[model samples]
Target: MTTREEVARKAGVSVAAVSYVLNNKPGVSDATRQKVLEAIRELDYKPSHAARTLKTKKTNQLTVFVNYLGDAFEAGILNHLEMESRMFGYFVNFQTYHPEREEELRHFMAGRIDGVFLLGQSLRPETLETLHKAGIPVISVMKPVEPGPVTAFVDIDWTASLQKTIRHLKSEGHLRIGLMANLSETHAHRTRTLAFRQAMKAEGLPFGETDILSGGGRLEAAKAAMLDYIRIGRLGEHTAFVAASDLMAIGMLTACRESGIAVPDRLAIAGCENVLMTLQTTPTITVLDYPRPEASVAAVRLMVEAIRGEPVASRLFDSRLLVRQSTHMGG
Candidate 1:
C-alpha cells in the first residue's frame, strides 16, 4: 500500500507537509496542497486511521446512538449523518440502544468514542448528567430532551409542525382525525405523540379513544394497527390520519388501499420526516421535511468545535410541511 512517505517523495515535499495537506491543516499553501493531493491520488495512498488518531490524541470518531426504530425515515437520517461525518474528517459509529436500559447508558459512557450523537426520543436527565460528568459532548439530531449544561441539540418545533398539519386538515373540513404512533419509550416518539394530542385538543377536534392506533414504528405493525382500525369500522369515519413517521403513514395507506378505502377522498394521511419512499408512492404522502442532511452537517461542525475546545453555537431548524397528493386539499 502507498504510504504518506511515498506520496511526499513523489510530490517532492516533506512528510510533515503531506500530513498537513491530507489532514486539512491550515498552514500549507493551496498550490503545495494541490500537488500533495495529486500525488496521493496517483499513488492511491490511504492514511492509517489508527496512526492519525495516535498522533492527534483524538480518535477522529463519533458515535451515534439511535433508538430501535428501523424505519426509512431513521435510515435516511443515518445516511446523512454518515455522509456529513465523512466531510468533517471523522468516522461514525452507530449503535442501537434500548431507551429503558440504564446499563446501556452506562456502557455508552465508557469513553469508547470522542463524542456522541443522540437520535432517539428525549434522553433521560440522569443520562445527560452522567455524560456531562464524563466531559463528553452530545448533540441531539432530531429529538431535544430537556436542556442541560453539556447538551446541545437541533430539532424542529414538533408541536407547531403538527399544528400546521392539523390546521390544514381542519381547513379541508375534517373534524375527526386519527393518529398512528409508535408509542415507544424513546424521547422522539413520545414528543411527536404528545404534539399530535396537543394539536388535536388545541384545534377543538374530538380525537376519540378509538381514533388512536398504537404500533411499533415498523411497517408490519403500522399495517396491522390500521387494519384493526378498519376492521372495527373506524377508517373512513375519521377524515384524516396523522402518523409520527413516514413509514407508519405508508403502512396506514397500504392498509387503506387493500381495504378499498380511497385516499384524500375517504382518508387523508400525513407524516413526519418526508422519506423518499413517501414521495414515490402512488399518491405521495404529505410530510414535514426535517432537513436531516443540514442538521447532520451542523452537528458534525459543532462536534468538531467541541473537540478542539472551541466555543460552539447551538442551532435549531424549522420544519416545513410539504403538501403532496395524499393531502391534496388546496393549501
Candidate 2:
C-alpha cells in the first residue's frame, strides 16, 4: 500500500530517486540507494507491478485472456500453463476477455503483462493491432483464431482430429452425423466446422445445413438448443452427433435425459476435448483427447521465449480418438 511518494517523503528524497532505487537504474548513487532501501524496509513499501513494468519494461508477468474461466475449457490449460511458466520464473494471471469491451481490454493489458494468451476468446482486429503496437506478444491457446502477424496459434490439428472422430463414428454404425459447435464465426469455430465437413466427406457420410447445430460453445445454451431440436423432431435419420466441444456433448446428453431419449442405443454422441467431466457422466462420453497438458506446456514455453525477444513459432499437437460408452466401447 506504500507509494513511491510516501517512500520518497520518508527517505528525504524525490519520487524519481525512489523510482531509480527501486529499478536499480544508474541515476541513483549508492548512498541514495541505501537510504531508499532503508526507508522502504521501515515503511514496508512494495513497488507496484505497474511501476516496475514502466521502469524496467519487463514485468515477468503473463496473462491469459478467456471468454470464461474455471469451466472445463480452461481448467487444464490454466493448470499446465501456470506450472510451466513458473518453472521459467514467470508469473501467470487469468483475465476473462469480453469481445464487446475492446477498449477496456486494451487498457487493462497495457503495461500489466509481458505477454498475452488468448484462450479461445475472439478479439477484433483493432484490439490485436493495439497489442501489437504496444509491443506485447499475443498467443492463442486451445482454439486458435486465424493465422496473422499479430497472434500466434497453439492448438491441435483440427482436420486430422475431426477426420479421426468421423472414422470412429463410422465404425460405431453412425452415418447421419451432426456437429455441435459455436455459432459465432470465429476462426477457431470455423476451423472445427470446416474440419467436420471435410471429415464427413472423406468418410462418405451425409453433411448438410440441417446437420449442424449451433451451441454458442456453452453447456446450458447447447442444452436448450438440443431440447428445442428434439421438440421439433428435426433429427430425422441422424443416428449420431459429434460435438465440437465436450461441454456441448454433455449438454445434449442432458436434453436427451429430459426427453426420455437414450444415448448410444438411440442417439449416439461423441465430443471433443476429453475433459474430466466426460468420465463422470452416467454414460461416459467419448471424445478426442485434446492433449491440453502438452499444448499448455508448449504454449507457455513459446510465449516465454517470445516475451524474451526470441524467435517464436506456432505449434499444433495431435489429437487421439477416445471411444467411451456414449459411442460404444471404453476410452
Clashes of each: 3, 0
lDDT of 1 at 113: 65
lDDT of 1 by residue, 1-331 (tens): 8888999999999999998886667899988998999999899898887677557545667878876546666777778888988887778988776666756766745555678888754666777677667656888776554455545767777888888898888877788888888776555777788778888888888876667789777777998998988898765578888888888898988998999888878889998888889878868999999888888788788887777667777787778888888888542
User: Residue by residue across 1-331, what tens digits does model 2's lDDT show?
Assistant: 8888999999999999987777545678889999999999999988777657776786778888766674686778888889998997778888777667779878877777778887765677787788888778888885555565645678888888899988877887788889888867663666788888888888887899888888988889889989999999876568888888888899999999999888888888998889999999979998999998899988887887777678888888998998898988443
The CA-based lDDT of model 1 is what? 0.79
| Model 1 TM | 0.78
Q: At residue 247, what lDDT does model 1 achieve?
A: 86
Query: lDDT values of the candidates?
Result: 0.79, 0.82
Residue 191's lDDT within candidate 1 is 73
Leading candidate by TM-score: 2
In angstroms, the error of model 1 at 200 is: 2.7
What TM-score would every model get versus the actual structure?
0.78, 0.84
Give the TM-score (vs. native) of candidate 2. 0.84
Given candidate 1, what's the lDDT at residue 179?
Answer: 84
